[model samples]
Target: PPEPPTGVPPLDPVDPRYIGPFRLVGRLGAGGMGVVYAGLDDRDRRVAVKCVHRVLATDTDFRERFTREVKLVRRVRAACVPDFFGADTGAEVPWLATEYVPGPTLADFVRTRGPLSGQALAEFAHGVAEALTAIHAAGVVHRDLKPGNVILAPDGPKVLDFGIARATDGTALTRTGGLVGTPGWISPEQYRGAPATDRSDVFAWAGLVVHAATGRGPFGSGTSDVVVSRVLSEPPSLLGVPVHLHAVLHRALSKAPEARPTAAQLQQAVAGLPGTERHADAGSPNRTWAAVSVPLTDPREWIRGAPRKRSWARRHRTALTAVSGVLALALVVGLGVRALTGEDSSLPGEPSGPGGTTGGSAATGGTTSAAGAPDDAPEEYRDLYETGEVVVEPASQDEPVLVRRLEPSSDGGEPLDQLRIDFSEAVSGEFVDFRMTIDLEYLPDHGSLTVHSNEFLGLRAITPGQENLDFRTVGNTGLLAELTPDDPTETVRLTFSGGVAAVYFVPLETRARAQESLDYPGGFCVPRSMSGVSETREVETFPGRDYIGPLDTTLTNGAPLDNCAYTEDSEYQ
Candidate 1:
């Protein structure tokens, strides 16, 4: 008897009554090519039903591919993959059923939250590796190993959707010019028109690992074209990955197919991994034939740029501003108001009294103010406000347009520095109002600013003002402010000399938390260092700089220490 079609109308007009001896219960998941339904077998066991798309059921090529996938999946029976139950080939929609496993997919889980941690990620990798081993053993290539395909059931990981997979001996189903699999996870070999293999699965797995670690793909976020370019031309860097597991992931992401470990090798290597969760001798029924309604072959069509992180500051700028007063302490030191801490008159190096630094001479006063408080209001409004002194631009008497003074602590206290400048009290004109000063042991000759995701870091120093500045690091990391303000001038500036000094400007509470985890690596307050010092050094004319390529090395080495490179590189897989 022909089994009644599942709930997807037109394909299955009648409600699905039974699939083989199993009684159809409800729908579990759905996709472009199929819909997964919950069902129960003869012994009243729960099962998943995957009903193929009607379009594919009518198309000879799709039908052949679907038939081949069902047969191939039957050969791989392991804990890592859903158990293959039975296929209702007799149904017009060609449904497959597998044991029902409850849990969110790795993709959905990450989407709802973010990336998984080191230990959980490691175990996830191990489980998937084992699954791929079983599939490869049957001479089938999964072709796709993205987070979307892995189900995080209560028991263990279950690899799903072998719809586009190719059997070693089966004929090609996709057209000659057609591309298969997710572009971000696609291996270099795939782009070069090389045959897909177990190694290709490894490459895709590495991309998923990156996504799982940083809540992002290794090459950053973008359209399929951008992601493909990165995979083909660029080498993968495991930034944001835990330092301990860097070596393990490098091997999996190697560009060269021959360079990567085989599924069995990867499985064995990860099996004894130190930090992993395991289940006892529990038995899980095969559910590979489960009814699923996901678009199996059109991955390229569904690939989307990872969602962008919206700044909490931008949404509630006013609330952020209020809270920012509390948080702004880390961001600004001297500009605090009563509502905010009212500006501190004792900024780094201002001489005492009006006769001291402000009014020494319109000549000395102008220069000193320029060097001391560039943002000071014009003398016209000296009494306009209580603390109406400029904190950003200083008087010209301050010497260099941007002067940094550092007083190193002999007692090993916090390294504190100050900048005193005085600009026109003129609240008018196109005044570029911003200040970035740091105190330390020394400064570097050249530097760059790196804006990754939401955080921005001024890596080094070329000069003090716009007259001679180097914009080398502006777009090096491909962080071109896709959604926010693109102009760097609008954002805060960070002026610092090259030197080692423990500096943090996070919220006081966050700063305390960071101090507590000084030894732990990763995340904010982890005590990452930069390369630069501010001690006495010969002044050199700042030079215009050129673009430095992407920093594609280990997180510790490639990323600047003060404004210089000091960390070591990791082995490329």
Candidate 2:
């Protein structure tokens, strides 16, 4: 027997009582493809089921495309996106069911509640960037990421309705003639008819941020064609944005995709904002923030031409002028803010465990306890230990890679010198294919990196073009790779062992709440010297005066050993 429709809305004349096994409860709305209905499963759980329009449902080509796209969308697994439940393309009116998220759209929220501010604003930035990171990692470009597509749910912001998302590998369903996104929030590349990429979505994300903060897009009000033309030609108007976010958003709304930060880069940059939260584990109460130099994917992407000193200060001054006197302190220090004086800033659904990660908090400021320590020391560093995340930006890449900075926990009262590393990202396109390359450390001249790993995952090194000096220390086994003798900008392969390992990207619940994976147990605990007299050093330099790295190893007391080096090289997996 056919299930009866759950009556709650003015349904479309063509709306069916049921699609596949689920009964349609009410019409949610419609997009270019078809009408969406609030659906219920056999056990009465809710799901958002979108059915293809009658006209397109009958077309075999469109049907095949719809089927393939649904499968592709299923690949995304971020908490920001609703869970993909199932899809039935063979049904008369093909439908896709996803976990139904009850919330008002960002557009509706902004229209009614005015603009988001303070911690709410910061959380939204982090959440959206997290979503973009997940989406782009899956190789999908959400061509339509306007406020209307984002829903403000009880938990946090959840990006929904991938009505026009296209796979990055030339799998666009829409033809070339018409615009593929909503105006004002649409990227300039979309207006110019250029193919969309991850960076393109970032451009739209900036517009979304602007709209969320000021209740309007950067382009203001205009006809769709006018808005498209304005996006194509003029710079975004950030008049109403707070000082801290303005500096970041300006770069995000760059006309050139290359000028903008990648989704991963944006995540790093947003951490410095006053309202930006840090990721810490509820289980690991003893573990504090550590300073780490993030490795980039390439060396060339860092050069944005002409480093203007006092530029950030100048922007701070501007933000100060624009904001009320009450926000003076925040405007000046907000860009460099790194507050670590409260409960860990873990977001809703964020996994917590005995092992947690600092998503490059070193970029904001390493936490430190030195009385004479530079005012700019990262906030992630703890007082007694040389532990925290280090953010590295090399010549070859834009995305920041994380390296742990751990020191033997100490009981000393004196300040200690610390270590800093310069890293250039791998230029090889085979990063996806190159499995088993875990646990890497970049050093300068003659210094080697000491790697301490979890039991299941061990660290061992391979020889690169330049030889590593033979050095041994107890409680710490050091592995180091130097720049090729001739070219400081040259690329090299630094391999690792302890059984082939790769970061498992599968999403769902995991045993390790702090571990952001389905399989990998844990990462290495990199040790640093916990002594006094801190200083900074340069690693290497490029022709355009863009040099970043210099091994800064110190000789202070070591912190307590989380896990010492593995003495044996084999017989374990």
Candidate 3:
């Protein structure tokens, strides 16, 4: 057990195994204030055990706050939430246990894949909104509702981590002047030092909806300073958001809390979207998760050098809703519209993920509008077009289908500018074995370009940045690949026969640029195995130039690259 990361504290050597009567197994995840471990009860049922940082565990005030959270959990009666198992604030290393959910976080799902389709987005949003309603009904404010806090189980979405949650009637109140959450997920009221309210959760929930719809956060970046500034003064930008849920997200994440709908109201507003599965316990079958045990190691090595004064500060680097009733009468009618439509959109796959392409970028063609952008673009480029989607094939020991498509807009204005295809859940292989196809209107002067490709994995980590992408994990997941073009058909196809969790494809030229700027050598991009994933495809066009690029660094190996391209000096280069 390396010293826990910022949120989680190092385990006590004298008492490492038990939190009261629950026996600890191994860590499930680590965060700013605590470590969540897989633990078992006498019946052998597995539960997620969260241990409070020793510093806070010993503080009387923090103890009170922690206990309040326990009470709050008990009050929230929604079947969507995990059942509270127990809380032992008095232990040398205080801990709490809740039913364990066996699934990836919603953040992981979208990053590995792409945004949820219109129907899926609607359904997911509805479930989250309803969960928020239940929390508010408990008279507690969740305070934080970000992508990582949401778990998308086989059943539906389950909200987790009530550590910063505050009970309206509890004796403690936000530790007096302390800020209690991740910046991007904090509500405006939270930044203003106002006591949190149910509406506070609404504000954060709104921001999350925007993040889910687009691959970016409403504030544009997840940096703490940027998020704080955006929440305090910026208007929520709804451009590129999945059209069907635009109005709902706009209203929910409104700058003014008053303008936002209540959690219950939001639920009603998004009621009955497609692909939302309602499970009895948010996919926690039998209120337990599979148990796997691994030996724990001393965490001192990783944390020893951290300065004592900054211990708390270091931990702070880290850190939802409801539905509404409307003019209840009007809500009923509107809900019908939402329900009957089932999220209308022409795009293939989920609307929010990396698979779908919206429209022309601001670069090559200025002022082009996305499909749902109130209306279509001007006549000049209206005819020009492009389409993209993330494609996946179940794991196969042999070559897998690899296809690429690029086409100009209706009138042949600009070549289909930027293209990216993300293949998730594909295993990594020693060699990059895949085929590609590209077709485009002829370039004015450039010689016709043809491509042959190959991708490989086996490389060293970038030395300039954090070598350990997962700062707290026991080991790192490393990947490398190379692509070489070999065909001439307007329609190109290739196959990769290997193991990989997923594969990402971008336009050849765009990829060349990304490889150069990103990996430094200018032709390769290797992501650490444990790195967070993203599938965003951002295409921007200048008045006469088209450039395709990534929206954010979802697979950031904790290194800075040149505009998502690989640079010569980069480790992968």
TM-score of each: 0.45, 0.47, 0.45
For residues 1-573, could you state the per-residue lDDT of candidate 2 as single tens digits? 222233224455666655654556567788766778876654355667887667666667766766666655666666667777667676777778887676677798788768887767766776788778877776667888899888765556778766334421232225532566677877777677788878888988898889888998898887887877888898889888888888779899999889999998887888677866644731111111111111211212111111212211121221111222223222223222221212223223221111111111211112223431224433333332333112121122221123323322322233222222223331112222211222243322221222221101212322121122111111111112222213222222232211221111111111112121111212222212111212222222222212222111110111111112222222111
Q: After the best TM-score superposition of candidate 2, give how far the Cα of residue 309 lies from its true spot, in angstroms.
A: 67
Ranking by lDDT: 2, 1, 3
* Candidate 3 stretches greater than 4 Å from native: 1-15, 167-178, 272-573
lDDT of each: 0.45, 0.47, 0.45
Taking all chains together, the TM-score of candidate 3 against the true structure is 0.45
Which of candidates 2 and 3 reaches a greater lDDT? Answer: 2
Candidate 3, poorest ten consecutive residues by summed lDDT: 470-479
Residue 77 C-alpha lDDT in model 3: 54
Displacement of the residue 519 alpha carbon in candidate 1, Å: 63
> What's the alpha carbon RMSD for model 2?
26.4
At residue 109, candidate 1 shows an lDDT of 74
Best by lDDT: 2
State model 1's lDDT.
0.45
